[model samples]
Structure formats: structure tokens, C-alpha cells
Target: MSSPHPRLSARQPRYMIVAQALMHDIETGRHGVGSLLPTEAELGQQFNVSRHTVREAIRRLTDLGLVSAQAGVGTRVRAQRPVNHYALTAEGLSDLFRYAHEVALRIDSQEEIVADGALAAFLECPPGQKWLRLQGERFVRNEGESIGLAEIHVAASYRAALEDTNRPDAAIYALIERRFGVEVREVRQEISALALTAAQAKRLGVAPGSPGLRLVRKYYSSSGELFEVASNIHPADRFSYASTLRLRPTGESEN
Candidate 1:
């Protein structure tokens, strides 16, 4: 006898498959905005999955800002597309990809520069290194308000990747990987408190001297070569960072 449920592909997680199907439904207006989704039991029955599986799928939707759940009310469609925000709760590199998808950078200027002493220290590179510098403002896709000022410095070798920086949908490192046939094996990030400079404040529409956060990320190749450095300065009210911590299981040793 054939199985009662539809065949699920082993290539992707079961919950993810269910989530993608539901997201498509939401986007197509099958489940219109503000409409409550079917209850767990109903969804489970329709998908021929357990209630736990349905709940997990719903949780994925919630993370993308597509729906919300309350104790008494059922899950409601919040938006057709993922909501853009500077707030990030990053667990790993994958989370960074999600963030990149939610926001876009609008380049305002570009130049080729040889790193001076101060620039070299900031980029974590030796002095006199040639780089293609791109400056821009970051925003929620299609929205007007700028959230941060961004400076992206790419090693001169991969300057060709700049061809697609205008493609609002592409990530810089991904562009480098595709154009240069290199892999970004690691990303080092540093965050610090700062006061917005007058120019930065003007660009971000924030007041000078306002408290802010400076985020710097260095992308490295599998062979330990640094390929790019990106720095973003965000107004205190516009951006937030969150992290999760978990305790190790018994008998697990720290690396």
C-alpha cells in the first residue's frame, strides 16, 4: 500500500518544505494578510504531518516576520514578504545570509585607494595594500529611510566583483566567490560602541554625537587570505544585535 502522506524529499528538512509551501501560499494571497491560518490540527491533517511538524513550520514563518501567534488567537498572516529590519539574532554564517537578503546597500561613491596606516589597522591588513572602496547607505529594500552608513573595501584582485554591486539582490562576498572562483571560509566580526560623526549622522538622518554601533566584518578565503572588509555604522535606535547561548551536553568538551 502507498503511504497516506505525500512523499517528502530527503534533500531538505521536512519542516522547511512545509514552511516554503505555506510561505508561497501567503505570498500568493491564498492566505491573505491578517487572515488566521488553520489550526495546528487542521494544518497537520492537510499536510498529513504531525502537529509538532506543523508547529515547527509555523515557527519558521514567524521568524521571517510573515506571521504571529498569540495564546488565544490562531496564527495570522502578517506580510506577503519578509519584513526588513536591522535587528539581527545571528547564530552562524547562515543568519548573515538571511540578514543580507532582508536589507540592501545603495552605493553613493566608489574609489581605488592604497591603505594608509590607519586604514590598514582598520582593515586588519598591511599598509599600502590597494583596495576598491565602496561607500553607501544601508536600507530596508524599497524603503526610503537609511539605517546605517556602510564602507566596503575589496582587495584589488577581486575588483571585478564590483560589476554587480548595483544589483540590490546580490551579496558582496557571494559576488566575489562567483567572479573569482574562491570560497569565503571564515568571517571575523567585531562590534563596538561609537558616536555618530557629523557626516555619518547626516547620511543616516541621525543627529551627530548620538550613540551608535560600529560593526566590522572581514571575509577570508579558505587559504586564510583576506578578501574584503565591510564596516557599518548604525544609529542606536536603528540597529540591534542579539545572540543565543546554549550549554554543552554532558561529556562534551570545549574546542
Candidate 2:
């Protein structure tokens, strides 16, 4: 005979368990979007966990962009669907790459054009340099929402690599490596707040003038040659990014 409840693993964090349960409640319509969630005391009692554990769980929810907590007011749901939360630990600087796996990126179009004027300046490309551009949107699994708009521009030399594959969303860089037999040595990332343009807003299912996050990344080879540049725009409410930083002792050189 099977036991009604299995023994819990000691390695599991209580806060994570509580968080998952709360997220389930949110996803299943137990707690609708824009609605206030139960108080910490209530949630603690319901989950049979400590208030501290509940607090941590709420923190996780906050980090995921599912809910927002106010000082006097209770936590309120911010999104209708489960937020795609990415946990970037200290081991990797390529946090956005980790995010790529969690969301579905469907390529909408691809084109080759010579970069000039402001576009060349923005891409850091020399005038008249040719680039292959892939435009797409990112969707969360099981959620029918376009959370982000992405534009990837590859240097002309690697354009054939992108053409060799049908599923650009899955792993474009890996394909490039296989095609060109080259490896990326460094990834430079920059983030900024942006107001959505009308076109971008329409594609991302957000209102014009809405606040969004702009992520710009540059991929380079061992010889310091730029291979690709990518820019992604995410609605402020639908996406959240978090990273864990480790403090090192003084006088320790970075590897």
C-alpha cells in the first residue's frame, strides 16, 4: 500500500514550497489578477508554515512580477498568468541566455540590410556594414501573452548559419557555432528603461507610452570580433529579472 503523504526531502526549502503553492493558487484562478491575496498571517495558517516562510514566499512572488506588496496594503496580484521568473546565480553572467530557455521566442521575420545612419551607430557597426536581422516575440509557456519583443542582428558573415535552421527560437547561437565552427568568448549586456513605441507596443500587446525594459547584448569571438547584437523589450508588468551576487573577500582577484 502507498502512503498518503511521502516523506519530504530535507534539502527542500520551506519557502520555495510555500511559494509554489501560492503560485498555483494564482494560476488556477484561486487568486485572480489584480485581486488582493490573503494576509501573511492567513497564508501562514493556511500553509501551516511560519510567517517568515510565508514572507519569503511572498518575496519570491514579488520577484517573479506576479504580485506587489505595499506597506499598509496587502499583496496584490499584478499579472494574470504565471510570471516567467529567472534565477541568475553568481556562476554565470549570461543571465538573459538563461531566460531564453524558459520562454518561447517565435521569429516573425528575417531580413538582410546594410546598416547606416542612426541604425549603424546604435548597433556599433561601421557604415554600410551588412547585417541579418531576426525579429520575434517572446511568449511564456501555457500563458497566451506576448511578453516581449526581440530583435537579433547577426554580422553578415554568419548570416548563412541562421538560414540553415528553421527553429531560430530554440538555439541560434548554438547553430552559429556548429555552422561557423566559432565560439563566443564574451557577452556584453546593457539594460535600460524605455517607453514603448506604437509599433513595439502593438507587437508586444502593451499600450503606447507604457514603460518597458530594454536589454541590449553583444556577442563577441575570441579575437574580439563582434558576431551578433540583440535587443529585447519586455513589458514592465510581465517580466522581472533577478540575479544573485556573491561577495568576495578583499584582495581576491576576479577570475
Candidate 3:
């Protein structure tokens, strides 16, 4: 007989684990909207983690608009769902590709440059590599508020692909596939929170140093070659990421 144990990957940070648990409870009605969550110390004890970890988890919930925290007043559930209603909801990893059609990118400038220093590190490329950098803002169709500021970089060899496209608002990967036959078969994405720079804040119509969600995505071709890298910054109040998950049945091995 096969063992019931499932293969697992590296563990996530404690804060993330705690945050996901709280999110589950909130979603399942254990913690209803307008209800106050347990104290950080109590949560820490219940989860067997430090109060700092619990605090960080609560911070994540606050960022998602699910809860609000105030000094001496305890954390309160603000909503069951995230505040932003994006034109496109990335319910799964593959759903990101559909963003080009759902939320159009309005290209502001296209330039060729040699990457070095911070830019090279950000793209995971060596210094002095040639790149075609496209800077733009993403907006929901028929909406007035700009949702995100994006900086996308494609290898210099692919510059012609973007230049040939009549629809500057289309996704970079789609443009490359149409013109150069390069297919993006896989995507690696990272999400984090940081204070927005002055330029990004101005573009998103938020004050400087306001909290923002930073998304870094790397696109890989079918041959396992990295083809494109993009960094997008969205105001915390303006964008939210979500996905649906289901539990596995007994005796089922993960795919």
C-alpha cells in the first residue's frame, strides 16, 4: 500500500502561514465582518508563534482590506472580500496572461538601454545586457483611475516585435509571440508590499510613501529561456490578488 503522506515543498514564512489561516477563518464565517479578532497575544499563543508574526499577519489582512487595525482598539473585520474590483481577476496563475485584453497597458515610452547596477539586479540579468524597456500605466477599460505603473523589459533582440505591433496597448508577451513566434510557457511571480516612490505615487494618484503592492514577474519561453521581466506597482487600495484552492481527496497524489 502507498503511504498517505504527500510530498511538500519548502515551508512558507510564519507570518504568511498565520495570515492564510486567519483569512480562511474570515472567509468561512468564523470571523464575520464587523467582528473583532482576538488579541495579537492570544493569536500568537493559539498559532504558537511570536506576537510579531501575528502582527505581520494582521498587517497582511489589513492590506487586503479584510481588517482594520488601530491603537488600543483591536483589529476589526472590515470586509469579507478585497476592496478593489479589477477588470481582470487573476484567479489562477495562468489568468495573468489574459490581463492584456482585460486591463490594457497604455505605453508611455519605449527605449533601448544597457542594464547595470540596480536595474540588472532587478531583472536578474548581467550588467551591460541590452534591453528594450517599455514604461506604461495599466488602466481598466472605461475607467478613469490608472490602476498600475508597469516597467517591462524585453531582450534587445525582441525590440522589433514590439515596434511592429499596431496595438501599443497589447501585452508584451503576446506581441512577441505574434511577431517573433516566442511562446511564454511559464511565469514566475513575486508579490510584496512597499512604500511607493514619488513618481509611482503620482502616477497612481496617491501620496508619496503610501503603501503599494509590488509585483515582479519573469516570463520564460518554451525552451526554458527567460524572455521578459516586468515590475508593476499598484496602490494597495487599488489592486488585490486572489486565487481559489481546493482540498485534495484521500489517497490522491498531487500532480
Candidate 4:
């Protein structure tokens, strides 16, 4: 049995009612970074209000940087950017990675390694090809939460670029583009079910073997050449991906 969600009474102004509920969600981190917010239709259905009322509520939230809308993408939770689009992206990766490093997220190791299996497939080179591996760990910034571990596998050729501090920034791909003239134009990631290792659990502040999001990402260059591959372990309850998709009228007729 579960308790009901808190809601303003029907007697109150509809916009105020919806706005309050949405604010509560933001304050509680229920709609944190990468959280795709419910659609106007969904909110209207949930609040038993008209779409116009829902729109006004959304507008208020948007003004607060708690929500954002794209032309084709309806609305997504603004990523870590306290202003807007907070989540880390290709363009923002350098800054976020630099911030993480500045905030004492340590880089454990950087070395050369030969990868086989799926990692090989993602890097798209012959098995045992030399790759530059970067292993780093992130903490909660203030609290010692030990967020998780990060591992990036880049071509050996990128090592020099990453080591160049004079470059734009330290994010591996960002450095590759600015220093080595390599541009990552696209990326694909895969998430697999996994039990956390003791080290991961300890770092994530979770029990050993706890379910986590094991992410594998393949980044490609502007020439459509595969450039880097990365594997990350994120606490399941703490990590998520959100995308906003606009809904077009199904009954509409096109010229």
C-alpha cells in the first residue's frame, strides 16, 4: 500500500495548483538532471486540468530553469546547468570535466592497453591495437559520496593532445579536436545490466553487486571515423538518460 501524492484542492486556482506540484518535484530532485518531464497531455491528465492551465504552469517552471523546450523536442529536465541544459554534452564536456577535475575528482591512471571483445568492436580496430586508457574517479564535491568510476579509451595518437595543457581543455575528445585536429561528430552508447563490483559499490556508496548502469560509449570523428570508446559505471538509482520528443498530430494531413 502507498500513500497518495500531495495535491492542491480543486477549490484553488488551477495554475497555482499545477505550479506548486511542479515546484515540489524540482525541490525534491524528482526531476533532476536528465529527467524528461511529463508532457502537457500527461500533466493535464494527472492534474485533471485543461491544457491551457498546464501550459502556464510549464511556463513558470521554464522561467526557473527547471524545464526547457526544443523545437522538435518537447521538454527535458535542464541538465546540471543551473541555468539550462545542465547535462554534459560534446560541447560542454570540456568544461564539466575540467570542473570535475578542479573539484578534486582524481585521475587514477592513464596507460596503453590492448582491448578485445566488445571494446574492440566499439573502437573498431583490430584486436590488440594499442589504445590510450584514462581511468578517473569522481567524488560528490562536498560530501565524500564517491560518485563512480570513469574509463576512456582513446587512440594512442590522442595521448599527446590530451597531455597538452595549452589546448582548449582536458576532456579527451575535446583535446583531440583542438590539438590533433580530430573532431568527434557523433556518439552511440549502450547500457547493460550489471552487478556492481565491491570497488564500484564502495565508490558509489552502495552495497556490493548492487544493480548499476554499465555504459559503453563510442564516439566518432567528423570524417565518420571511430575515435574513442569509453566505459562507465553509474549507480542505477542515481543515473538516467532523458530526451524530449515532440508529438505531432496523428490525424494531420500534409501537402
Q: lDDT tens string, model 4, 32-62?
A: 7667778889888887889999899888767
Error of 2 at 224 (Å): 1.7
Ranked by lDDT from best down, the candidates are: 1, 3, 2, 4
lDDT of each: 0.81, 0.77, 0.80, 0.66
What's the TM for model 3? 0.63
Clashing residue pairs, candidate 4?
79-86, 79-87, 80-86, 80-87, 81-86
- Could you give candidate 3's per-residue lDDT for residues 1-255 as a string of tens digits? 111113222387888778877877787778898899999889988888899999999999987878989899999997776555463467665688776677767778888999999988877789999998888887777765678988889999888888644336567888889889998888998899999999878777667998888888899999987779988888877777776678889999986
Provide the lDDT at 87 for model 4. 31
Error of 3 at 254 (Å): 5.7
Once fitted onto the true fold, the runs of candidate 4 whose alpha carbons sit more than 4 angstroms away are: 1-105, 139-144, 164-169, 247-255
What is the TM-score ranking, best to worst?
2, 1, 3, 4
Best by TM-score: 2
Candidate 2 on 1-255: residue-level lDDT in tens? Answer: 111123334467988777777777777777898899989889888878899998998998887878889889899998765565423333574555666666666788889989999989877879999999898877775566677888988888888787755345455666688888878888888889999999988876656998988878888888888888888888777666666668999999998
TM-score on alpha carbons, each prediction: 0.64, 0.68, 0.63, 0.53
> What are the clash counts of all predictions, listed in order?
0, 0, 0, 5
CA RMSD for every model? Answer: 10.6, 5.7, 13.1, 11.6
By lDDT, the better pick of 3 and 4 is 3
